[model samples]
Target: MCSASEGQSRRSPISTFSPGALRRVLRTADGVLVEAVYEPCTAGFEGNSPAAGGTAIVVAHGFTGSVDRPAVRRAARVFAQRAAVVTFSFRGHGRSGGRSTVGDREVLDLAAAVEWARSLGHPGVATVGFSMGGSVALRHAALHRGRTEARTDAVASVSAPARWYYRGTAPMRRLHWVVTRPTGRFVGRYGFRTRIHDRDWDPVPLSPVESVPLIAPTPLLVVHGDRDPYFPLDHPRMLAAAGAAELWLEPGMGHAENAADEPLLARLADWLVDAAARPRPAAPDAPRTA
Candidate 1:
């Protein structure tokens, strides 16, 4: 177990953040303790109180990525400049303990983070996810649009796979090998510091494409790289069509959050902030006019 001081003292995305930011371990519904960092928005932009109107961005990292990874930290810092930020490792990654159910059970981890952000009294919250995290974000928004809890105001998915078991690309095939084979799981546990569950999806949870429409009344943005080696353009296209999501297909982009440039991330931040400001529909079934 990590002491509070160690978590606070740990290196982050440079000195961009103050030391007082909260470090916490949130437990999921099933009892997995998730390690997370929540940084309240600083003064540069505005508003700390919910009535004053500020949005919190809950960022989910890609596969093999953790809250402590440089990419995650950089994204968090950039978003923090404008809004509160919460970054956490999926179970089996980083300080969080558990076996990775790949993407199925990870939604609980994100749900915990979102609930935490809401608990801070930030009425509006947006979730930004990349790759595997992106898929999980979509599913979480669908399954728990927080009907009884605080709902996600907006969602942005970057370089996400629309469907499951897609082995169209070389990288994806290797990933399949890694997830299915015992040797691959062993290597993932030690080599990448990411633990993979050996078993396949029992019932097979909702696919990213299928999860999109369920988030209709909630603002959604799907961003993808044209040059992405993992998933082709078809993935985002499918997701956009089903969910009525706005798709931004970047020409020179590669794959995932790490490859995205600062300019793109900045635009994404603005979109989330704007989405948060917009009023949520009266009902979940209401079609998004915006």
Candidate 2:
């Protein structure tokens, strides 16, 4: 019953993991079993830390990234040193189900994963997402705003732009237009074998810029490299202009620095520690529908 393109685009299911990795498969709200990994807390979860009020952190990957991505795994390891860590592949990205909606359905995917992590008996939860995953984290906060009191404690978005509209004056802008338009067209017809939404859907309702106001007062940390080329420096500035979250513009770093730099990881671990110590604010007023 499948078309030639669909059949050709189907990826093989993932059935394994590396030696140090611990895998868990959980069904999503839409009945898809997503592949996730729980890198245990350093010194194990047995005795003192849980009693001492340590928090749990979840790491979400960038666009087309999976739990297996080096940056994601690295961030998990870094945070694992301080707290229990949970990381997962978004549906259709690695070992999960369905297809990519950029940040739309990915937010729901994150929500489902957050719920699963909470059910595992962790007292507090927070999420750190990179790039597209960062946008998804923001959307997740927006969608579930006040509901996270008993679940997620805070969220951090790394190198994620607030809008789909790229204002950078480089090959990156052209690259985005090409990917969101022509490349998406080609992928829809051939590569991924999935129906593509209209261009309007590509922006407006799903944009992080459009959704930033929804995440204010929820204890967000926005970190971006000063020299991130793919997403310009102005991106985080725009989010900060909204004045709802704390912003840290790393000096002279580029996108995906956490994966390659041990210091960044160390800094991130410290940041999470500090973020957990701070009291999170109440959710901002709800959005007005047109």
Each model's lDDT comes to 0.80, 0.64
Instruction: List clashing residue pairs in candidate 1.
Output: none
lDDT of 2 by residue, 81-146 (tens): 777777898766666767656566676677667776676666567887887788877777676766
- Consecutive 10-residue window with the lowest summed lDDT within model 2: 1-10
Off by over 4 Å in 1: 1-16, 45-53, 284-290
Q: Tell me the TM-score of each prediction against the true structure.
A: 0.89, 0.77
Candidate closest to the true structure, highest lDDT: 1
Residues 1-290, candidate 1, lDDT per residue (tens digit)? 11111222234553554344778999987899999988776645434333234788999888888888766787887887778888999998888989887789998899889888888878788999999999988988787764535358899999999999899998888887777899988877777777888778888988898889888788899999999889999999999999669899999998887777888888999999898788766435322111
Per-model clash counts, in order, read 0, 1
